[model samples]
Target: MTCFSPKFMAFCAALACLSGQAPADTAQGAHVSIELNALEPIEDACRISFLVQNGHDTDIEQAVYEAVLFDTEGRVDRLTLFDFGALPAARPRVRQFLVPGLSCADLGRLLINGVETCTGDGIPADACTDGLELQSRADVEVLG
Candidate 1:
């Protein structure tokens, strides 16, 4: 099952930022990309699913992704997703996050904040050391 917890997201947010890298930055030596696949309204909240593709020569054992949803009034909400198991090289892994009580109409933009803890090929490295080319989605609309 998908793990949906703000505390975990907060922890990831702290750990990822502590490494001294901007969320928009990509990890060097790691060919990884993020794509937002869906953003739909559910009740009062919205659900977002996306893919994390590994293009490097090594496998990705785990990753913590943080994203921010912004509204027109400047209210910001954080949505986080993670794959703590394994993501093979040149493959894609799908993950999802939920923004509680947030409507799709309220979303103005989506930003991929950062990626945390990338381990593979029997080594742990900083994926965001060189800055990532963030794949952010704008001009998005929710359809019923």
Candidate 2:
């Protein structure tokens, strides 16, 4: 027969749980997350807001992405470059763009085509587009 103390059994259980989970840093991975925060109607245009987060340890001097907007009928509405300037490390910032001659209700989807420019002092070349995560809080869908 084998016997184990209560303290030893508890320690073993804790170790097993820890082993099943990934480390905190690696869990988030090395990437940038862009969240479509809101859409507002302004005059005859649509104001699109984005919540940008840099998960890297360094600052990003300039980050621009080629975005494509689709109409409610799933047809391409317009293509433009959104420049989110100077993203700080581990911080979130809101950037808004006004689409002239477009209505907020007509937007159905937003697609992140690719990274137009991602530059920083020590950041990787593909830091902005690599493993990019897209989210949306509005009715429109955001895809990468």
Candidate 3:
């Protein structure tokens, strides 16, 4: 028979317990993280890029979010819908939107107001919105 010390057995038990538990961030539930990846000025318009990641086990056939843009003075600039189509499970995708007549310099913040539509097989209706995490890499702030 193989021999294992008492301390080694205790360590093995701890490791087994940890392997069964999910990460701290995903312990609550699956989440969709949207990160404002970048903003670029292109010919009098701003190209906004978002890095989206689906943490769930099911693929999202369609995902749209109502977004609100704020100016430097914190005044609402505009509202629009961003369509991030076909988010595969546990995969990250970058989606870009070009806003006409808007400059990246004038943008203060972008808020994910709500989920306009989230549809997929065997997925919760609120899977895209619930426990959503918003982050920013550009100068503009992003909120959920």
Ranking by TM-score: 2, 3, 1
Per-prediction backbone clash count: 6, 0, 0
**Candidate 1 — which residues are off by over 4 angstroms?**
1-30, 79-85, 128-131, 136-144
- Residue-level lDDT of model 1, residues 1-144, one tens digit each, is 222486665554345445432222222434556666677788878776665565555676776655566775656655554443576665556777667887877777766556656666653476422334445353452111
Stretches off by above 4 angstroms in model 3 are: 1-25
lDDT of 2 at 109: 97
Show the colliding residue pairs in model 3. Answer: none
Estimate the lDDT of model 1: 0.56
Please report, in order, the local distance difference test score of every candidate based on alpha carbons: 0.56, 0.84, 0.84
What tens-digit string does per-residue lDDT give for candidate 3 at 1-144? 222786665565345334542122334457788989999999999999998888787899999999999999999999999999999886678999999999899999999999999999999988999899899999898988
Q: Where does candidate 3 have its weakest 10-residue lDDT segment?
A: 17-26
Query: What are the per-model C-alpha RMSD values against the true structure?
Result: 14.3, 8.5, 7.3
Report the C-alpha lDDT of model 2 over 47-120, residue by residue, as the tens digit: 99998888777889999999999999999999999999999876778999999999999999999999999999
Q: Candidate 2 — which residues are off by over 4 angstroms?
A: 1-24
